[model samples]
Target: MGSFYVTTPIYYVNAEPHLGHAYTTIVGDALTRWHRLLGDDVTYLTGTDEHGLKIRQAADAAGTTPQEFCDRIAPAFQRAWERLDIANDDFIRTTEPRHHAAVRELLQRCYDAGDIELDTYSGKYCVACEEYYTDDELLDDGLCPIHKRPVDHFEEENYFFRLSRFQDRLLDWYAAHPGAIVPEFRANEALGLIRGGLRDFSVSRTSLDWGIPLPWDSDHVAYVWFDALTNYLSAVGFGDPAQDHTQRWPVDYHLIGKDIIRHHCVYWPAMLMSAGVELPKGWAVGGWLLVDGEKMAKSTGNVVNPLDLVDTVGVDGFRYYVLADTTYGSDGDFSYDGLVARYNADLANNLGNLMARVATVVAKKCDGVGPAPRADSPLADAAAAAVAGATTGWDAVSPSRALEATWGLIRATNAHLEANEPWKADPGAEVDAVMGDALEALRIIAVLTHPAVPGTAAQIWERLGMTGALDDQRIPDAVSWGGYPGGTDIVKGDPLFPRIAS
Candidate 1:
């Protein structure tokens, strides 16, 4: 098996976790899970960005130290991921000593290469975004475009990365790797930024006291961009020789929102080049989850608490809707009515109904013992087609498409059952063949859809009386037709997904 590493941009601790945060994290979790099913060793890393100007200010507002403030808020993200069944391999915090070491190493390497030099700057900065904005990039009122607030003027002596020198190198790298960024449009955007101009960005801030100190210069601390982005490396032992860094050095996918394209696609790679580090293999940039035609933000007063929706539909239902409703690279409008409608339509009426009908028919027609499926079962071709389509969709990082392909098999099997009328047939070879084929189809569906809905898939596996942990089942081999040997007792338990009231 090959190694696969994926990451979600670490969430800032300045605010509590919201639906926007949950969507990115869930997508990472699902992507890593898919890799695991393919028999690959996967590392899914996500955590909190605990050090920034915003964090220092937030601590003062809370009447506590920055560390205490982070300690209180960081666990909220961990708990939210747990509630959503996010199976991340590592949860990193910027405050961790390991992360500090990695940032220092990267900084020293860039400094040694003459890519970092002392500089002074004065500009309008957004406390919310912890970024500087040019006059042309700001609103007509000279406010931060992202937060729509007055920008604070800051002048400081800091160390800057010589990003200007890497312009040609960055362009050449992108030209060599055509698909380095998913959704080809984003790759073009990164190329455009390089083509426009590259400026030396500050790597260390003299004003921030709550950050990792530079290795060569103790008076300055690593800036937010440098410190926050190093978590991807620190979690994988970038500076620690005791761990095998080469195994997963270059991440397979760096999943991020469209808003941070410049930082990830542009700044990150240039930083890596200066440090003599390998660049990430691919970047999957997703658009914002908008609410009422506006991005969800505290300033906008439209942030969605994912937990509240979880309380409505169960965890799996919530996970399925978000993945199925949003095409990964495009904006998705979030609405409560839309969520309930998707749950009732796809889960309760379609998949859930199919499960109940099959188990009940097996109990009555085949004496509750699932029979072995026919090698040439009517559903075999459909199952093979579904597998191909699902694999293609997942490979392209399109969860909506992958799930649509999976449900194709589910829908097809339901139609097959309806046409045959297995329930009406007497308990004979005819009924056995139909029921057995349905069970086989269910087995394949369980394996294929396990990544998106792990708990629910496990439940389906259990009710099928399948032996062994579902997670241990590998793709291709496990999903091949006729893998379900059947002859085990079937349980027609409660509905897997009960209908949600309109």
Candidate 2:
């Protein structure tokens, strides 16, 4: 058990929460929860990027100050996370004083290091992304490549970060830290960026009046690059690391969406190195959760409100589909049909049916009491295999694979009961033994799958008649076979997850 820190990119407040936002945050919460189960001291941080041109324009359109606009939009993220049951340790906003101080300190450090310098900037600019593009980089028809919208011609003097100087260093860093990026292929994509060539990026904006001012020159406000990325360090007390952030300096993993890979993988690491901060341990990149074969967009009229999905499938049901259906580093085509199909198969039928049958059998044959399992029960080896598989899958940060491994045990036990015809067995020693093994298996499954479906896990824990808090039980000891003692009252309840209509 060691300190494990994870973070989700501070979401942009230009828009409310959506499927993309929910997917990244949910993955972070699940991964952190698993680390906690291993007894690791964990810090999970998430927040909003409240300073940028998008927000400034959004505020103008809404007829309000930037701060007031942020106040209105920031709480929507917080409320959405609460509804989604995200367990973030800190929720930071770029507008906060701590963030302002951290951003200024970092800008000063880099400027002092000769990495940030004043330069004339003239290019096609995307206000939505706060990025400048060269003619070659823009779409052939003269539009922003990403937004696919026409970019405005702009010219201003701004401070720029010497990103060109970091290409060799970043390549060397990745070579030294081989697993710094997950899914291997994603790392290659980042490497391709470095090998292609690096360019100095603007770090301050003279035209934007809604950002933290440069410490050396108040007229030039920090740009999206400085203000947004600095939130990671500010949340962990960056400048005063020896005081409270020494051990937690380098985060274990940053769960990010693929759209912002350049910002997180290339630019963010270089910024940290320039500031003399330790680089993050790894980046777990996930692709966009596309809706109807297209990225969710208000412009496209295909934006899927994440909370609205909660109305269709319960929260845990929604979490399961996102993690289970989507491969972490690849684009996942999302649809209501796909979500409902996965919910019915994985959560409703496989897991929920197992819970219902086990409790129902126990109530009828064991007088509503959990029976004890012998050390060498029929399900012993299968239980051990499930435990091992789930452990390995989680260590690789694959929640879908982990849950599949845990459910393997449930399926095996369900099959065991079906073959033995435990209900037809004489209701004496035979029935008691069969029910005992199934109950014990359920206990193990609950503990293993808790990270993804916490509320449901807790429910199964209570039904299994385990004492004390479910999370208090340690893994190796808690999951070892034969923990279910006989004679404990078992209260059978409604099905854990009811089947959705087709």
Candidate 3:
């Protein structure tokens, strides 16, 4: 089987986890699960970016050492991931020794190749952004554009990566690998950045002591972006000569927020080219999760804890809202009312209602045993079409669209039941056939939606009396027509989704 590697940007450890962090992590988790469902060897990596001025400041304010502070905050992320059912293959923290070794090696290679140079630079810097802003780029109030916060003026002698030289090279690489960036428009944006000009970016800071010290020069520490970006390669054994890193070197996708597109698409790739590392295969850029039409910020108390959302709605319900309410690449405006509405409509009213109705009919009509769906069932063709839609939608990396396609089957099945009135029919072979088809339709749905709502899928699977692990069931055959054998003991469980009152 071919290998598929995917990574979410290692989160910064200045604060606890929030909805923004959970959003990207969940997308990565879902995609990785999808790959596994297709039987591809998959690796998913996510972790903390611990070495930065923000972390250092936060640590100082907490009256703890930076390492101690990172240790305390890092597990918050891990614990959140665990609670959210994230199944990452590995979690690589920047403070790990492996990460340090890899970052140093990468920096040294670029330095040796003459791409890194000592330069005296002065600019308006945003510690939160870890980026320099020119006069024109700054906001009208002379604040950093991204954070809308004050800027720190600094001048220093530091090492700069020759990013200016890679503009043409980046264009050439994108030319060779068209569609490497998703949402097509985002690719156009990257080209716009290249078509405009690239400036050399500093990769080392002399004043920072919390970061990894450059190998060639002990006095200067690697800048946060330089140090942080290497975690992608460091986790895959890029520094170790004995390890076979090539098997997973080129990742299938790098899922990141749109704010970091310049860093990942431009600066990171240029640094890799300077160090002779292969570039990433693709990037799936996501828009921000907005609260009140503003970006979620902990400083402003606008951040929403993902766990709190879990408490309000079940994990599957929350996941469904996030993945279904907004298109993958578009900004999603979050609201409690919207969440409840989508949950009640899709889960409680549509899929959940369908399951409850089917199981109840089977109990009274088929003696509580699932009947095999007839070959001539009308839904068989509808199921086939839904399956193809879901497969293709996910291939485009659009979870919302995939789920929409899967819900199409649910809507159709409910319509089929309404038209035939299976529950109203007399007990006989005809009623058995009707309820049997509905149960079979649910079996297909469980397989189709497992990636997005795994827990709910498991519940449906056990209620259906399927024996083996839902994951172990092969696709294309499991999801194909007529997988639910007749005469299996079917249990009519509680409502899969309880509606929240308006």
Candidate 4:
């Protein structure tokens, strides 16, 4: 089997998990699930960035040590992912000994390569961002562009990475690897940062005690960004001599939010180049899930706890809405009304409606045993079209378009049932043909939509009395028309997604 490795940015452990975090993780999980469907050997990694100044401060305020604080808060993310049904292969923390070794080895490589040097620097720094910003980069109010808060001035003696030297190299790398960053515009944005100017960034901090210490300099700790970014390498056994890291080195995709574009796109590649490590194959940058036209944050008091909505809309309903409503690369405005509308229209009305109608009709007309579909079924062309569009969309990381294509088949099947009025027929061949086509359509849908809504898709599969685990179903062959060999007992159980009252 071919190999596919993907990672979600290890989340900062300063806050509890929220919808913004959920959005990115769910997208990664969906993409990995799609890879599994294609019969690829897939590895999905996600975890917490547990060591940083923010963590120390947050821990101090909570009357705990940094490690204790991380231990307490990191599980919140694990639990949240579990509740949302995320199937990540490993969750690496920056504070782990494995991560520490990886960070040190990377630092030593760059240091020995003459890329890291001691330097004295003074700059305006945003503690919230944990990075320095130039005067021109700041907002009109002399505040951070991201946090909209005043930055503190810091001058210190530290070690810096020769990022300035990699401008030409990074440009050449991007030129060689076209479409390394998704949403072509974001790739251009990275190119702009490199073309505009390159500055050597500080890699070690003298004042931060809550981070991985530099191996060369016992007086300093590795920058949080550097420490956090290496989780990708460490989880794959980058620094462990016992493990063969090359099996999954050079991740297929480093899924991240657009806010950290500079770090992942610019700083990350430069560090890898300096350490003589292979650059990531690709980066999928996603826009923020905004609330009332602003980024969701604890400071804004607009953070939507994903668990709070789980009770209202079932997990699959929530998952379907996020993947179907947002275009994946664009900023999505999250509103209660929008959420309810998407859940109602897509889940409650479209997919759930299709499954219920097919099973009910088969039970009433075909004596509860699904009839075999025709090789020349009317939905054959529609199913083929859907599989084509969905394959393209998922390949391009466009979940909304992929799901839209899948839903098109649902809409078409519903129309086919309506046009034929299979229920009105007297259990005849005509009714059998139409109902059989609908059943076949549903089976194809279960495979197509499994990545986005696995739980709901499995339920549909079980209700159809298909033998074996739904997860065992592979793509292409499984999705082809006429795979649903009918004659299985069809269970018209409870509504898959009951409509939520507006």
Model 2, span 1-502: residue lDDT tens: 8899899999989899999899999989888888888888989999999987888999999999999999999999999999998888999999998889889888988988889999998988988778988899989999888778999999999999999999989989989999889878888888898899999999988888999999999999999877888888888887554456666878889888777778889998998888887899999988898887888876778888899999878888988888778878888999898988988988888889888888888778778888898789989999999989888877877777887888899889889889877777667888888888888898888888888888888899998878888777778888899888777887678877889897
Task: List, residue by residue over 54-136, the lDDT tens digit for candidate 1.
Answer: 89999999999999999999999999999999999999999999999899888999999999999898898888888888899
Q: List where candidate 4 sits over 4 angstroms from the true fold.
A: none
Candidates 2 and 3 compared: the better one by lDDT is 3
Q: Report the lDDT tens digits of candidate 3 across residue range 1-502.
A: 4799999999999989999999989988888887888888989999999997888899999999999999999999999999898889999999998899899999999999999999999999998899989999999999988889999998999899999999999999999999898878887887888888999999998888999999989999999999999999999998878776778988889998889989998999999999998999999888998999999997678999999989878898888888888888889999989999999999999989988988888888788999889888999988998889888878878898889989999998999899988778888988888877888899999988898899988888889988898877766888888888888888878888988887
Evaluated at residue 149, the lDDT of candidate 1 is: 92
lDDT of 3: 0.90
State each model's CA lDDT, in order: 0.92, 0.87, 0.90, 0.92
TM-score to native of every candidate shown: 0.99, 0.98, 0.99, 0.99
10 residues in a row with least lDDT, candidate 3: 238-247
Candidate 4 lDDT, 186-287, residue by residue in tens: 899889999999998988889889988899788999988889898999999999999988899889999999998889999999999988899999999999
- The candidate with the higher lDDT, 1 or 3, is 1
The best candidate by TM-score is: 4
Candidate 3 contains a number of clashing pairs equal to 0
Q: Which candidate do you rate higher for TM-score, 3 or 4? A: 4
Candidate 1 wrongly placed segments (more than 4 Å): none
